[model samples]
Target: MINMHYTACSLLKITFKSLLTFFAREEREDTMPNTEPKLYKLQKKDLVACILRVFAKLVLFSFHRITMEGLEHLPKEGPALLLPKHCTYGRDVALEAIALHRATGRYANFLMRAIASRFYEWAGGIKIARPKDVRRVPGARALNRASFEYIRWLYLQGEVLVAHPEGTRNPYDMGALKMGVIKHLMDVENEAGRCIPLVPIGIRYRGYWVPFSRIEVKIGEPVYADDFENIKHLLSYLREQISQLSGWVI
Candidate 1:
């Protein structure tokens, strides 16, 4: 009734050969470093970006009243992830990042779909391929590989990243938070670098489609990346925190 080979394999949790191969590949890719500068750093300044930032502020301040909490939770002297509940169809969700810059003087780079006629390279915003659909394009794999490196570099350099965990904006529920970002965060955490925070944010709006509306940004506790063994656990913690803060059910 006892097979020694089976016992050892079971103890090792190596049942699925395909899963093992996938994880092995992922682990190998995760530990490697990407040194490309263009992918990570902005080289030139764009005037249009300056105008847009100002315009965004004007609309945020003049058209809407913004309130925020949990200022103390932001990382004091290290890189951190600013995961916010994206207010779909409203530009005001970005006000949370702007607010971070105002409070700490650290610019938050948004991870967005590829944009042309956008801000300068120095605008601190990271642009990835469009549609953000990872499965349909051959170039998507390449883009994602480069982006992983760039994002890792950003966090190590004490930069703040503003990304939607839900991947795309959803006006209704928070939508399902994806695991890709969390996996990368785990990779970043295990490397030898400064500590960073994975922050969860919640945003609520009233009269959002109206010309002017009020928004409340609630910042919750930060989850240290190195503390989790798997991305699923990390994602669960994130969903719970965001749900608790925004009253949005998971």
Candidate 2:
């Protein structure tokens, strides 16, 4: 009976998503003007994207009942890097995006895996290659470079970029950290001549074996780039801090 209920809910979610996609496409088609307007018009696709993201947040919050702490530590203004622990498949990304938006009233540009780029492209996300696979594909290499360039532009434009330095979901166990976050910070520092504030976010899921388990997100104080000797040490310290705060042993 529980399995049947879970299956029914999953099917309902898929049906809703299909309906949203159909309407979004129809809205985009209907808004086309032959003359080409002077200013770009926002289409239904944009609205659909926002609505879909909100739907995701509602589902997550309903299931997990996330309680956020230290949200006040995030800067009210200026570009910053939000580094969160990777967990629970990809749900953490949605959790962080929604939480950050709620706190700052600014949408975060998440640095997502290249594989998820197509889905996120619709929602205005920047895709970065997993550092391990950066050397495998030529196109990925280009995309990685382009992704960094875009991130740099966004930072200068004063937007927050959320990155997961662990590179992949760690399944609640400690995993080796990647250097993409460090590299991006160093580049930004070189261009801006100062390190951007790095906010460490820790997400914990209660009862992974149970369906619709609770989630807790702890946002830590922003760590300034100048506090560490170099990018390596900075990332190491950030990892340790996040682990300590989240009660996850690294």
User: Judged by TM-score, which candidate is best?
Assistant: 2
Model 2 per-residue lDDT tens digits across residues 86-118: 886546767787777678766677776665423
Candidate 2 to truth, TM: 0.81
- Clashing residue pair totals per candidate (backbone < 3 A): 0, 0
Q: Clashing residue pairs in candidate 2, if any?
A: none
| C-alpha lDDT values of all predictions | 0.63, 0.68
User: How much lDDT does candidate 1 score?
Assistant: 0.63
User: Each candidate's TM vs. the true structure?
Assistant: 0.74, 0.81
Candidate 1 lDDT over residue span 1-250, tens digit each: 1244234324323322233344233322222133233554543243433444555575456555678888778766677888888766325334665667556755566776643113323445565654444566556656667777888887777777777887776667767788777677667876855567889988877745444467777888888866877667878888778766776876
Q: Which ranges in model 1 have alpha carbons more than 4 Å from their true place?
A: 1-40, 43-51, 89-93, 115-121, 130-132
CA shift at 60, candidate 2, in angstroms?
Answer: 1.7
